[model samples]
Target: MLSRLAAPILGIPRPAKRVIVLAVDASLCVLTVWLAYYLRLGEWVKISGEGFWQPQWAVAGSLALALPIFIVNGFYRAIFRYSGLAALMTIIKAVAVYGLLYASIFTAVGLEGVPRTIGLIQPMLLLLTVGASRMLARFWLGGVYQNQLRMATLPRVLIYGAGNAGRQLAAAMANSHEMRVVGFMDDDDRLHGHVLNGLPIYSPADLPSLVSSLHIATVLLAIPSASRYRRNEMIQQMRRAHVEVRTLPSVSELAQGTVSTSDLRELDIDDLLGREPVNPNLLLLGKAIHGKVVLVTGAGGSIGSELCRQILAVGPVELVLVEQSEFALYEIHQELLGRVGEAPVILHPVLASVRDRHLMQDIMRRYRPDTVYHAAAYKHVPLVEHNPVEGIRNNTLGTLVAAEAAAAAGVADFVLISTDKAVRPTNIMGASKRLAEMTLQALSAAGSQTRYSMVRFGNVLGSSGSVVPKFRRQIQDGGPITLTHPEITRYFMTIPEAAQLVIQAGAMAKGGDVFVLDMGSPVKIRDLAVQMIELSGLCLKSPANPDGDIEIRITGLRPGEKLYEELLIGNNPSPTSHPRIMKAHEEFLPWPQLRARLDALETALDATDLDVVEALLTDLVAGFRCESDTPGWNGTATALAANHA
Candidate 1:
């Protein structure tokens, strides 16, 4: 019934509502001033008085002065529901101004028995009346936050902090119609059992009970300054209680260095990394990029894109982006342009394959880049194993072409982005990468001016076709997560960190240097999937939980997939200036001999002869053993021998 009566007022435009508030303030000014006179006289009503409630200029002037003063103080500009101490301060100022003006004007008019003390009492009365009026309206009429009250229909949530960020988040949630805040779950014993924002704050140990009692479906982590390990522990506890989880951005991403509703976001997969990222070495970051022309192949790929972003930030003179995919190239190019926003870095997006020798040389000569970051290659194990020919042609031959061009163009520094699988390869993809590294090693040995190096790290978290994103999508789709093997393990790093480490390693390189990055630890694929499922507030389909939301299924390993990945090619590793990067002393064939073998491999590949390709890979790659000599061809050994003959 109240809403029905207020419909007309609510239907008015927002600014028009402020006009209504202005008129209401004028009325209150007159009423409060009259009330002030009564208080000064110390009387309830003058029933038998000759001049009872006499008309006075002071009363008339009260409305005149208060209305303009309130407008000037911007009293009506605040959203009533969201108003706080700032709004109250504005009211105090307006009252003081109106009262002073009223006193001076009415006193000079000498208008009758208005005591001078009434002037002092009137302003204080005005402040109380105006402040109370807005509070009453906000509390009773549901001032713009009426929709927020509708949030009771949605899932109830408990915040996990009771400090400033948590309090602010609770208030902001009160303005959101998507979810409702039930209470706070904090770890501080001092804050336990206290009521904040009219909601109780409970200890973390009480979360399970509170969650059940309140039917809370979500737990928001408003502790932005918390370490990743602590956040993970909290999330694990909440998820174990079978409740969903959300979190705000880190402390640095908060608005004005404080939490805001806009800063609230869902938890990303990286939150599971369980520690802070390492601080990068600035001198190393600037060594290759600052004021130098840098060219990156595969500049549209995941690691490639991150390298481009970081390189652009470090004041590169010009950036040459070489990518084969049209859409991918266009996307990274447009992103760089928008992000750079007219920065002096010259962005050149080249649409050409790294395998094309002529195009590689042409661009290298045209740009005359000082540093070349070669990142192009086929990386997926299963896909590359199935299509070994294309994989070898791209990863192996592409590196040769890019390196040769860089050498011919006198590019001073060259960095090849490599992977851990290249160390002791079981798959065609890894073997191809190993050969690519050797190609660069050979080029560096040929007395080229370019200081060639390779940075080999383990799997990056969000790289294309990596397990993290694949798992995220499966979980989102109500999944039976497919794993290759129960015991498979791989090292993980963030994309930005991988790229930064690669740049740093390249900066510290001499000719033919193979730098192995310090990947933190090897995580079991099975364990990672289990942790992911648990963190998603879902139980695994095992003996304990017969009726679980998600299941992990073992799909036997692919043909070329390895049970473990290794970062080092050999035992010898020399320490570098940076702790996370190490220089490896590995042997490579001289360019004089490598060039001839490359020609033979190219010839064998062009003829579509898989037998020779397999033989060459087995003989040329160190520690590469062939499980079966099957060329995956229709012909038998006799036919293969005759064909080779």
Candidate 2:
């Protein structure tokens, strides 16, 4: 009934609200003065009492002092419901000043009928009444007293650390209506069983029991300084408990601000696969590109775009982006332009295929770049296996065109972005990449001004056609997570880290050097799927637990897919200046002999001779295994041959 009555008052105009509060304060002042007299005289007092210094005089004087002081101190201007400590302090200060002035005029001046004690007693009574009124208003108007009921409906969470970040995050979330922080779980034994800011600090070992007892739906990780391995362990523990987990970004990313609920992010999948990235060697990274014109082919691709971003940060004089797709080119170019901000670097966005020899030659000649990064290729294994001819034409033939153009244009350094699939090839894509590597090696061996090298690494997370994004989408859609094989494993890294390492590797390259990034231990496909499901607050739907949320489905392996990938074909990789980069000593064909075979392959490709193309690719690329009966290869080839005729 009181809340319904207060609702209309809350809806009143600001000016009317102020008038109402001012009138309330006027009445409070008069009542406090009478109460003071009644307390002093030990009897009821009336405002109509006689004399020049009567009770009526005291009421009028009190109002004159109190109302103006309250108004000037912003007492009437404050919104009562949202008022806090600062507002209360303003009240105390204003009342103290009013009390001092009232005492001087009424009591300290030695008035005959006024008692000096009433002056002191009246302000003290008024202070209590004024402060209590605001509190009561906040409770009634803001409905803050109902927070207990609201909190019960909010999702309960436990912070996974008790340090400064955890405390700050808890404080920031205190008013949040979405999630209620019930307690903290820390690894520290000393903090266990203790109370922090009225919340219990339980040991991490009790997470399973705590999740059940407290009904915790999520765990927020606040240990930003924790290593990747340590974080992965904690995440696994939460997963086993069947609670969802989110985390704060790295300490460096959190440097500029206090920990807040908005800063929480989903667990990074990359942390599950790799170790802490080593800081890039600034000198090595800036060696080839600083103050020099640079160009990157496939410039809008995952690795290619990242290379452009890092290269721009390295302060290149000019950055030319060569991409085949018009939309991809426009997107990356616009993004780079936003980051350029006052930097003198000139950006050139060119829409042209790397396979076009004349176009590539023209771009390279026009830029005469100091360094060229070749990242364009058809990388999806199954897709390339189905379209073998186009995959070979783009991956193998395109590298030859780009590298030769760079050399002919007198570009100083050329870097080809290779993959682990190129090491021991079973698929058309892998064979084509290996042949591209040979093209660069042969070019370097034939003695050109351009120094050609290749950087080979494993799968980059979040790339198009990568399992990471596919898994994320499946999880979001409440699905059956699909994998090619239960036993299959693959190496993974972040795109930015891969690009940074690629640049450093290219900078340290000598002629024909094949630099391989040291990808941490490969992660199994089944384990990855399970971890993803668990971290998403879900469980595997299997016979063992039929009530689980999502099922992990194993599809048969696709054509050209491998159970695992290798970074190097040969053994004994030598360490480079950077700890993460390794140089491999591998054999290659000389240019004269390789060129004749390449010419024959080109002729065979133009003639639509699928059988001859397969023979030449298998003969040219080491460890090449041709799947003659790969599902769609024969049908596509037949269609192409008939169309050509």
Candidate 2: 10-residue stretch with minimal lDDT: 627-636
Q: Rate the local accuracy (lDDT) of all candidates.
A: 0.81, 0.88
Total clashes, candidate 1? 0
In candidate 2, stretches whose alpha carbon ends up further than 4 angstroms from where it belongs are 1-142, 145-148, 628-636, 640-645
TM-score list, all predictions = 0.75, 0.78
Instruction: Estimate candidate 2's alpha-carbon lDDT, on a 0 to 1 scale.
Output: 0.88
Query: What digit string (tens of lDDT, one per residue) describes model 2 on residues 1-645?
Result: 886587567678889988888888898998899999988889776688765447877788899889998888878765663257887888899999999998888778745666778888999999999988888787777674456558889999999999999999999999899899999999999999999998999999998998889999999999999988898788877888988898998899999979998999877677676388889999988999999999999999999999999999999999999999999999999999999999999999999999999999999989889999999999988878767778889999999999999998999999999999998798989999999999999989889878899999999987888776788789999889998798999998999899999999999877998999998888897888888888888889999999989988888888888898999898989987788999988788999999999999989878778788888887888888875456435435776566546
Q: Where's the lowest-lDDT run of ten residues in candidate 1?
A: 46-55
Task: TM-score for candidate 1, please give it.
Answer: 0.75
lDDT for 599 in candidate 2 is 93
lDDT of 1: 0.81
Which tens-of-lDDT digit does each residue in 1-645 have in candidate 1?
Answer: 775556465667888888888778887777776787778777743322246344355567677788877767777775473256777777777677777787776554445656666667777888898898877777656643465437647889889899889998988777576788889988989988889978998888877787778988878889988988888788777766777777888777775765666776656656776755767999999998999999999999999999999999899999999999999999999999998877799999999999999999999999999999999988988777766778899999999889889888989999999988887798888989999999888887888788989999988887788888798789889998999888999888889888889888999888889999887768888888887777666778877888998888899888777888988868889898887888887777888888888888988777767778878887788877644334453334455445445
Candidate 1: which stretches are off by over 4 Å? 1-149, 255-262, 626-645
